[model samples]
Target: MTPDNFIQNQKQQSSTPYPYPYPPPFSGPQPVHFSQYTPPVADSSILSHIMHSISSIDSRLSKLESMDKKLDKFDGLCEAVDSLFTRVKTSESDVKKTHYSISNIKLDELNAEKDNLWIAQASGGSGSPGKGSKLKKEIAEIHKQNSELKSTVSDLNLVIRPSLAHGCAVWLPSSASSQQIL
Candidate 1:
């Protein structure tokens, strides 16, 4: 047979119009053979598997949502803790300031008291004017009185010694005798 006729014969013997083993490349819209086309049948096991996968995905999504809520609560708690920490720091600073102020006040008071005490000691007896001199005058008067009492006692002893040596009753004033007896 001739080559062209042999090629034509080969085309007629094949099912497709194209002489190549693969389908033809892109062309205009072709008529679809719906009569020979079959819709896919639903498989119970495969459908169940897909449903289970979707349910698992939904469950995972729900868990993630719950975790997100928990994270939000945790973030709020963190903020509260941070605020509390700041307040604590503020309180600590205030306390330190108060302590320093109190200590300074106490020191100032102590220094004033020390100065007052030194002044009081320098002037004697509560820093009153002439109070120390008055006490000194009183003490001197007491000493003078004590010396006079001693002289009088020595005179009495002189009078009593002779009478006791004679072993006789000495003439004495009643007051002197009473003083001697005492």
Candidate 2:
């Protein structure tokens, strides 16, 4: 038979009623049966849903990346803190060395000052009163001689008053004026 006739015959057989009185008619489409017909989906809404999911995932990925950067910065800070701790430890040693040097210098100065004090005491003759009294007498005698000379100069000043070249007048007591003129 011809292809068209064969197709028509198959259609007629399929459309014919079955002998069973209770069976329902095949209510679906004629079984053209090529590829399966999935009803066309409302793809725009689905596409939007898929894009939203992707955007949410992307946002999460960005947050993770930001957290990673913050962790890196924290690690850098920890390294800096370790370096500072090392410097502080080194400074402690330096401080110890400086303290040692200062103590040595202080001890040497103390010894030198002690020696100076001893020398001063020794020169004052075992801290005796007689040596101190003798020194005082000599100092007093020297001051008395200085006063006598000042009196002589003041007397000479009175005599030479007219002959002397004057810058400014300095007052001299009559007792001490002798040394003033000379």
Candidate 3:
């Protein structure tokens, strides 16, 4: 016979009630031979086989449920990370506003410094007004703290970058849109 005909004959003989990736549908009462006369399959053997199949199906279903639960937990964690990023951004904005207002106050103090020279001289050549000096120190401290916070937030982005990349992969098989991360 030609190869095509032989292959077609093989296909016809291999009967299955379900599509690929699914188990073939179970047929009832398969005959088993133990002697020349061909005795029927023992009841105990049939019961054991059925039990084994049922156990396998149950385990697979249980594993599927466990995976679903883990995905839910991962989703919740991603939301929490997104919220934390939002809070950090809000705090950064607040700090920026405070820094701007403080800078304005320092500018006013600088303008007033020329006028305060007489007071400084009156106090035995101290050369600096007490209140102006105090304001300068405060402004310097604020600038230092703001710079530190900015650097910290920038560092946090470094850590978040790789985590977000991996998390997107776990949540979506296809490439996710850019808006999803933000």
Of the candidates shown, which would achieve the greatest TM-score relative to the real structure?
1
lDDT tens digits, residue span 1-182, model 3:
99788767766776874443477744875545423356556799899999999999999999999999999999999999999999999999999999999999999898789667756644434675475567667878999999977876676577567878777532222323333342
After TM-score superposition, the amount by which residue 180's alpha carbon in candidate 1 deviates from its true location, in angstroms, is 49
The Cα error of candidate 1 at residue 118, in Å, is 1.4
Model 2 regions more than 4 Å off? 1-42, 125-182
| Candidate ordering by TM-score (highest first) | 1, 2, 3
TM-score of each: 0.51, 0.44, 0.39
Candidate 2 lDDT, tens digit per residue, 1-182?
A: 99788767766776555432355755877555535656566789899999999999999999999999999999999999999999999999999999999999999999998887656555565545466556667878999999989887777677667546554444456655343433
* Per-candidate local distance difference test: 0.80, 0.76, 0.73
Candidate that scores best on lDDT: 1
Residue runs of model 3 more than 4 Å from their true location after superposition: 1-46, 118-182
Clashing pairs in 1: none
Candidate 1 per-residue lDDT, tens place, 53-133, comes to: 999999999999999999999999999999999999999999999999999999999999888866775556666567666
